[model samples]
Target chain A: MQRALTLAALALAIAFPMAAVPLDLDFYIGFASRVMIYAIAATSLNLILGYGGMVSFGHAAFFGTGAYVVAIAMTHGIDSLWVSWPLAMLVSGIVALGIGAISLRTRGVYFIMITLAFAQMMFFVFIGLKAYGGEEGLNMPHRSVIGLGLNLKNDATFYYVVLTVLVATLYLLRRLIDARFGRVVEAIRENEARMETIGFSTYRYKLTCFVIAGMVCGLAGALIANQTRYVNPNLMHWIVSGDMMIMIILGGLGYRFGGVLGAIVMLVLDEAISPYTTYSKIVIGFVLLAVVLFAPRGLAGLFDRKRVRAGGGHG
Target chain B: MNSATRMTEPVLEVRALCKRFGGLVATDQVSLDVRPGEVHALIGPNGAGKTTLVHQLSGTLPPDSGSILFRGDDVTHLAANARVLRGLVRSYQITSIFRQHSVLDNVALAVQARSGSSFRFWRPVRDESALFDEARAVLARVGLADRADVLAANLAHGEQRQLEVGLAVATRPAMLLLDEPMAGMGPEESERLIPLIDGLRKDVSILLIEHDMDAVFRLADRISVLVSGRVIATGTPDDIRANADVKRAYLGDELEAASGGEA
Candidate 1:
């Protein structure tokens, strides 16, 4: 039953842009693309925080790093999507490697604090870069050229692109979590001492998961930069990391596509509620409270009953 | 048969190991050895530093001044996982199986660790039938084959203890550091564990730290009595039973009762 629901959801997602085009709601296409991008970021965060049990609070650093990679490359007249996207992922992955290496040495709240500190350090560095608009942020001239007559500037095309990437990321992560490496990470989360005694170098495995999540989030960042045509230090803020964390909690931690579901719910709620009042955040805060108070497992938990059973044994 | 004949190269050797936490001496100049294929039991009262000594041997705790040799190699500085890779594994006194995973998954992970690089990100773990086959064999060995599909958290206390040993044994360790494998088990459960543990010595040496003196005496080829962070006696089961110093320092009437029950 749940598998059929997931397939139906995927079908609806793929047909969303087409349905929007016929309805003449072109602006919603861009909005949906933004949702897809955030979904990718949130999903990546879930890999470490939910699965690996490494609650990183500096994920926005990787996201912002990816955005800045694109912005900086554009400033240098290198506007190819292929070059900039891979470069963004590579830079974010390297930063994650350095940060994870240091942060993973400490655990629990200490790990969270260290990752936050590293991200704030990156934020301050971007703020101090006088050449890149500093605090105000930089603007992109246009979206990257994909070649082969594909125009990313077209909203419909861009939505499809974002959807493709989101679908691919979800599919890959699904396969990854069931793989041997994924099992090891989950085992480490369940019992680090037991994992070590069973011959797993958990530190190495955790660092690897951290790096992969960072790189995937970086891809989201690059897409966001293209969507907004802007890069700023605000993207690397600690609150942005908290927001992604909230999305995971709001959707359901450790659920395969919970991140996507969470991003959609959060973004749609923001879009709907923000027009009526300036206190959208306050309203959202209450919703989060309700979710936590009643459905402790998040929105995805309502759909999949097995999660409640699995979640019961968590230490 | 004789002391000299049994004195071949020991599989594990701890030389004058000492550890101090503030003013408390947890392990005080403890020295011991486990010969190949023998169940060398370390028996002690509560807070006797048996767990501390086991931690040091398993590479979890670093001793202040001592060395641990495994198969004649100095492994005092090796990390816990590295020591495990070298075929030295330990089980927890508290049951520590992966609670969320099925019994098969818990054992399969151990087999996966010994198989190859777990860095393979794409292939599904279920596709590897060899690991499941070996994991099933390990579960069967521990008499948990029937419960292989059950979540580890749902198992009874005795079953969980058995699964814990299954996890440790799946790694194919040359020496097993079992920390109270019979802890919290009823008499019947302990009875079941006795033969399971006794059968393990044919494949690997066991360094057992147990409070259950009956199980220790039944399984131990050599017994070491620890009192207040020190080894008070080391001998055969009969020698330990006859040793006055052991009785005076720690064993007391329990040894007499156990020996009488055995006779």
Candidate 2:
């Protein structure tokens, strides 16, 4: 049934160019593209935080490195999409690997603080970079394009591409989590010591997950760069890391579909609340706190048939 | 006893291992040997340092001073997990398992660890026939093949203990360190566990730590007694039973009262 739903979504996405929703307005497409990008980032964070039991708060460093990869490559006059996007991913993966190797050496509150510190350090490096826009930011002359004849400058065209990538990425993530690797990560989450005593090397597995997450989040950063045509130190801010954490918690920690719903709900909330008053921050904050306290399992807990049946048929 | 190289040599040899926590000495100069496929029981009273010895042998704690040789390799300083990978598996006194997962998933993880390469990110655990087959076989061996789909946390305490043993066995390790498998069990459960543990002696070497004297006497080929961080005695169950100092340590009056009260 999930496969069919995914297939239907894919079919609709493929036919979307032909059956355009008619919301080609720059504002609507832009909002959607940004949400899709953030979805990628949130999904990656959830892989480690929710499933693997590694509460890393420095995911923004990788997110920013991804953005920097594109900005740095373009600043050097390398406009080729092929060259920039892959390098962006590689650099982010390497950074995550290095940071994860060190930060994951500790556990509990120490783990969270270590990850946050590493991300803050990265943020500072970007602030210190007078060569790239320093405190302001950097902008790309043109968006990335495939070698094909299609122009990526078209807002509608790029929005659809972002959507396709989001869907495919989610599909790949689902596959990865259901595999033997996923089982082991869940085992670690459930009982790290038990897994270790059974002859499994846990640190290596966590590092591997950290790298995969970084690699995926980097791709999201590449998309974000193209969407805005800009890169800035703000991309690596502690607030951005907090945003990803909020998304994971609000959606549902361990639910595969929670990350996607989290991104969508957060985006929608931001868009809606900002118009009501300047007090939008108060409302978002309370809603987030409520979710963490009252509904920790999040939206997917409501949707899971197993959970529903087990939860006295509440669904 | 000098079957040095082949099957006769001990799989694990411990010598004068000591661990101290602040002013209290947890394990003091404990020494023992575990021959291959032999059930070696370490019996001691509360705070007698049996667990401290197990921790040192399992690599969870570093010995203040001493050495551990597993299969003739000096593994005294290896990390707990590294020691586990080297085939020293320990079962906790309080059953530590993945509570949310099905029993089959719990054991399958053990099999997956041994089969090498958990990097296959597309194959479902249930669909991995090789893992499922081995998991089922292990559950069967531990008398839990029927509860494969049941969540581990939801199991009765006895069944969870059985699964814990199954997990240690599924690793197919050269030695198992069982830390009081009968700790909280009722008589019916303890009765059930003894044969299962006795049956394990046919294949697996065990460093059995227990407070249940009868179970220890029934199951151990050889016995070591710990008294306040030190090995006070090492002998067969009969030798241990005949020792006057061992009786003094456990209290002869308490033993007589217990036997009188039970009868």
Candidate 3:
């Protein structure tokens, strides 16, 4: 049943852009692409926060860094997708290495606070970059050129790109969580002392996982920059980090693909409620409260009742 | 024991280890040794600093002033995991298996750690049949083979203790630091653990801190009685039983009860 649901979801994702045109709901193509991009970001956060048990509250630093890489490259007349995308991922991974090395030394609330502080520092740095439109943000005149007659400016084509990346990210994370490295991280999450006694340097594993997650989120940030054609300091805001965290919790903290489900639900709700009232956040907040109180395992838990009952529900 | 054999180098040596928390000295100049292939039990009264001493030996607690030598190497300053990698592994008094994972997975992780390639990121861990086989052998050794699929949290208290031993054994340690291996066991469970632990002496030396006097007396090749953060006696079981200082400090009543139970 679970496999069927996943397959159905995948089919829907692939078919949505094509279906949107004839259905006269073409705007949904770009909207769904945005959801997929956020899903990529949320999924990356889940790698560290859910699987590794590193509650990094400064993920936006990587996201904004990736976006800025694209924006800055565009400002310099470098429109190649291949160059900017890899550079974005590499730069964000390096940033994550520096931040994670220091932040992983502290644990629990201190770790959370430290990551947030680092992200805020990045936000301020970006805001102070006067050449890149400063606080107002930078605008890209055109989407990144792949140089193979492939146009990312087209909504349906771009939607396919985002969808492909999301699928690949999910696939990579699945392989990762089932790997030896994944087992060690999960073991560390369960019992760090025991993991150490059994011969694992948990700090090293966590730092590496942090860097991997940051690079993945950085890729998402690059995609978002192209989709929106804008990069801003607000992309690295603490509230954005909080939103990604909320998506993880709402989708299912440890469950693979929960982030995608969460991003879709959250983005859809945001779009739906915005037309009704400017206080859409109020509605979204109440819905989140309901989900937290009733489905502590997140929306994915609603599908796997047996797992929750068996006490093996963690993703 | 032959004099030459008795003088053989110790596998673990703790010399004048001391730890103080503010004004209180938790481990006050404690010294002990475990010769190769011998179960050297560290017995003490409550607050006798046995756990503190264990903490120092296991590298969890830094000593104010002391040194620990393992297999003729000074390892006092090494971190816990580094010590573990050097073939010194310890189990907790409270069972510390990976609670959310299956019993097999708990042991498998230990085996994986020792397998020298846990850094492999792309390969699925489940496909590693060698790790599973090794883990199964360890579980069978500890008599937990049947419970391998059960979650650690779902295991009986006795089974968790067995799993704890299995986890340590999976690491293939040269020396085992067992902290209360039978802390909450019934006579039946304790009976099962005795032979299981005694069986390990041919391969690994053990520095055991157990409150169960009967098991300690039965299993220990040499027993050290610790009272108020000091070793009052270190000798054979019969010698420790006859020591006046040991009787006065602690184990006075328990020794009598243990001897009576034995008879």
Ranked by DockQ, the better of candidates 1 and 3 is: 1
Ranking by lDDT: 1, 3, 2
| Model 2: how far residue A139 lies from native, Å | 1.2
Per-residue C-alpha lDDT of model 2 across residues B3-23, encoded as one tens digit per residue: 556587789998878789999
| C-alpha lDDT of candidate 1 relative to the true structure | 0.92
User: Per-residue lDDT for B144-242 in model 3, tens only?
Assistant: 989988888888999999999999999999999999999899989999999999999999999999989989989999999888788888999999988
Better candidate number, 1 or 2, judged by DockQ: 1
Ranking by DockQ: 1, 2, 3
Better of 1 and 2 by lDDT: 1
For A42-149, candidate 2 gives per-residue lDDT tens digits of 999999998898988889988899988998898888877889889999999999989999988999899999999999999999999999998888988989866677
Tell me, by lDDT, which candidate is best: 1
What stretches of model 2 exceed 4 Å from their correct place? A1-26, A307-315, B1-4, B251-254
The weakest ten consecutive residues by lDDT in model 2 chain A span: A306-315
Model 3 per-residue lDDT tens digits across residues A60-108: 9999999999999999989899899999999999999999999999989
Clash pairs, model 2 backbone:
B28-B229
| CAPRI class of candidate 3 | medium
Instruction: Place model 2 in a CAPRI quality band.
Output: medium
Task: Please give the range of 10 consecutive residues that has the lowest summed lDDT in model 1 chain A.
Answer: A306-315
Alpha-carbon runs more than 4 Å astray in model 1:
A307-315, B1-7, B256-263
